[model samples]
Target chain A: MKTIESRSNPLYKQLFKWQSSAGRRDEPILLEGVHLCEAFLALGRQPQYALFDQTRITEPHLAGLIENLSEEVCCLLPAGLLANLSNVDTGQGVLFVVRPAVATLPTHLNANMLWLDRVQDPGNVGTLLRTAAAAGITRVLASTGTASLWSPKVLRSGQGVHFGMHLHEHIDLLAVARTLVVPLIVTTLSEANDLFEVELPVQAAWVFGHEGQGVSQSLIDLAALRIRIDHAQAVDSLNVTAAAAICLFEQRRQHR
Target chain B: MKTIESRSNPLYKQLFKWQSSAGRRDEPILLEGVHLCEAFLALGRQPQYALFDQTRITEPHLAGLIENLSEEVCCLLPAGLLANLSNVDTGQGVLFVVRPAVATLPTHLNANMLWLDRVQDPGNVGTLLRTAAAAGITRVLASTGTASLWSPKVLRSGQGVHFGMHLHEHIDLLAVARTLVVPLIVTTLSEANDLFEVELPVQAAWVFGHEGQGVSQSLIDLAALRIRIDHAQAVDSLNVTAAAAICLFEQRRQHR
Candidate 1:
């Protein structure tokens, strides 16, 4: 029921700051739109605050979402203010600021996971997470050069899968590779086994790298297997997200 | 070299118009960055005009690219002018205006093809085209509701694959589906065969629909088979581009 009209308000300034760049590690991430908020609520995770556009709050869908939230967490913002806080051109009229659940990496990795080495595009990083989650991979590790896992663009691209998975960012991937109990599968451009021809391991860490500069030599040297997705020779390489989907699902098919 | 420093100039105005929206059917499409330009040249196609930033034209890479073109086709623009014509934040200092090669739809469709039904996102549409090309689907048809395939953002995301593919826009997909010789495979959310378990046709028309909406009922009714990619129940569905990659590559794998 609280209405914040001034840009100078402490809460509004904090929201604005969090929307721009990677905030402090512990800061609650900004989740935009009804779908993401619904996803968060489905996980039984409560938002620190739920901000809605005052004019559009009476719309049936937005009102339905409001009824599910605790009255204490709801706040009203003018349409302009709400739009300004949104990353997309058309504001979705609702936003959730939720602190993600903290996760710790296991000492000895035995499960199938994803290692993103400098996957700079936020959309690519987020889609990879979504694909990894759908394919039943529960943990994902990203090097420092990777896009911020909690960035707004990524959260939008990731849809709601971030809730059900363990995400470790700014990781020392090479060090982790050295300590892994499972095979490390690296995808490369050439001189690698065709993905369809190889016998994939049941549980391994799949390493996908930067868009232009692929898997680093250190990780390549440590890979238990190197695979490439064979395509018509016209394309230089598959988009990272596409490659991830094909590889992850192919693994699923093999195990099935 | 001719210098274009004024925004009011006719040539500059024409380039500006082409950059903003879908131009006339016969208008030349804009190709940005060195990679795209190189791709265009590799096809043995020359741009109607190559515009470069005056100051950056002397850079080694740009200069080398310049050597391949006839001096009559080149023009220089002030940095500010050239940057204004770019879509990305950092302009690559080059842009090409070239009329795309005309393509006609075959009356009796037998080859593997892609039918995009109201796939509105430029990035998604473009990425789909690139994926189709890489998977060896030579022909792509898009309904009117789909994003303009020749738009700048689609061209950028498509990389250079547009040059090699036969792209038909503003299509009546239902009409085409009715006359198809090969099977029409529709991707659906539920009540469909699992993609991996099904016997995929070697030559089929794969229909990927809008982002939020699955394939239309009309298309679904005409489908020889409806297939869905099975994934974890936690997430709603795979991103369209990701879904296309999985489906296309799976077909390729089975055929091989």
Candidate 2:
């Protein structure tokens, strides 16, 4: 395998771009650690290229992974250089340059879908995606202000669910709301139906809003159902991800 | 108000110590940002001391908080000095040194409680605490290997729910399980009843395990109920916090 020792190497500079949020767009993003790499490979897709830290090549898991990849698409880098591109504290000693499958918004948003209205935190966004996928929902849309779905932090928090999901970002949610045929369920803080007591539609578009602010007024005006998860008054509200899990799973529990 | 201009100031050093996980034990931990400070004050608790960045002290929220505090216990510091002790990216120009209420284990572990088994990530542990509190489960126990409950990261992610929870850390689970009067609900991967189909107990101790490992074999053996959340199977499992929310809220729904 070829070794890249210098920081100034062209390939190293190209890989470095994949580490930033801006770099994540359009370009193939870097997938770190064994879990994500394994997830990507499990989807019957191949990485454009793979990099392994020379120091960890002998490790059993890393070695087994390397043995599977063709020699041309694999390379070795010194530990320091590899660590520089790693977003996590402990570098996993491996990264795959792979392009995520581009997804298109469906004409009818009728499935049990999730619409994120500017969910800001990367972890929250990622966790919502994972929760949605686990609930067997295949489609998700995010407004412009939401965290980028493919950012490294979101990817790590997502824990490999991104592969199985069909995600659309920078969405015009208002426009979509106008034409939507399914029940539009928006979570509100007050004066709404209780999530548990409400008659949930079999398939609907669920909207979760910004962390600090609840769903925007325009969306609330358009909501076919405005529901709230009733909790003790001691705490103001549940975390967005936690709320999503409860709401989605409750819907699942009812239909099951 | 007193002004602290030097990094060599003893008070600054003491505040700096509270920034680390090791410093959180048996000491007044620092509470950052307006939300957390407001949450603490809402509990009708006074800060041992409060610090504000000199540059942003005139801002309305900071000024308002300062107005309510006794001048003797509040101090002003340069923005740089204040930022040094901050754990979050954007410093809110304020910090409160408050003592968390000490909690003792009650003889009866009979409440609808959550037992965290070696949950490692501070974010996960904090989210779990926040979720548990929102679900109206006031008591939570964390095993020894779990993240430090009072660490700065956990406290930040917890979003002031720490003030409402009766948390006991460094717990011996097996011993607690033996004497536990209520049903012990443990989540497992296989050969268990489905969470949705199972008849959940009205009052039980819910056990959520480490991120990678399910509940320990010993604990699983002792479980009164072994349950697993049925998902699409495209992903491995629900996040620990997500699972806790679903289980706790489901119990709430059953009895509601």
Query: Considering every candidate listed, which one attains the maximal TM-score?
Result: 1
Worst 10 residues of 2 chain B by lDDT: B17-26
In candidate 2, how many Å is residue A64 off?
3.2
Task: Name the lDDT value of residue B71 in candidate 1.
Answer: 88
Tens digits of lDDT, candidate 1, A6-32: 899899998898877543477777888
Provide the interface RMSD of candidate 2 in angstroms, 1 decimal place: 0.8
Pairs with backbone N, CA or C atoms under 3 Å apart (clashes), candidate 1: none
Assess each prediction's global lDDT (C-alpha) against the native.
0.89, 0.88
Candidate 2: tens digits of C-alpha lDDT, residues A1-256: 7789999999898888776643245778888899998888788777888899998999998997887787888889999999888888897899988887789888877788999999999988889999999999989988999998988888888899888888888999999999999989999987799999987888999999999897888999999999899897668889999999999998998887
User: Which ranges in model 1 have alpha carbons more than 4 Å from their true place?
Assistant: A21-24, B22-24
Docking class of 1: high
| Model 1 superposed RMSD (Cα) | 1.7
Q: Which 10 residues in a row give candidate 2 chain A its minimum summed lDDT?
A: A17-26
Q: DockQ of all candidates, in order?
A: 0.82, 0.83
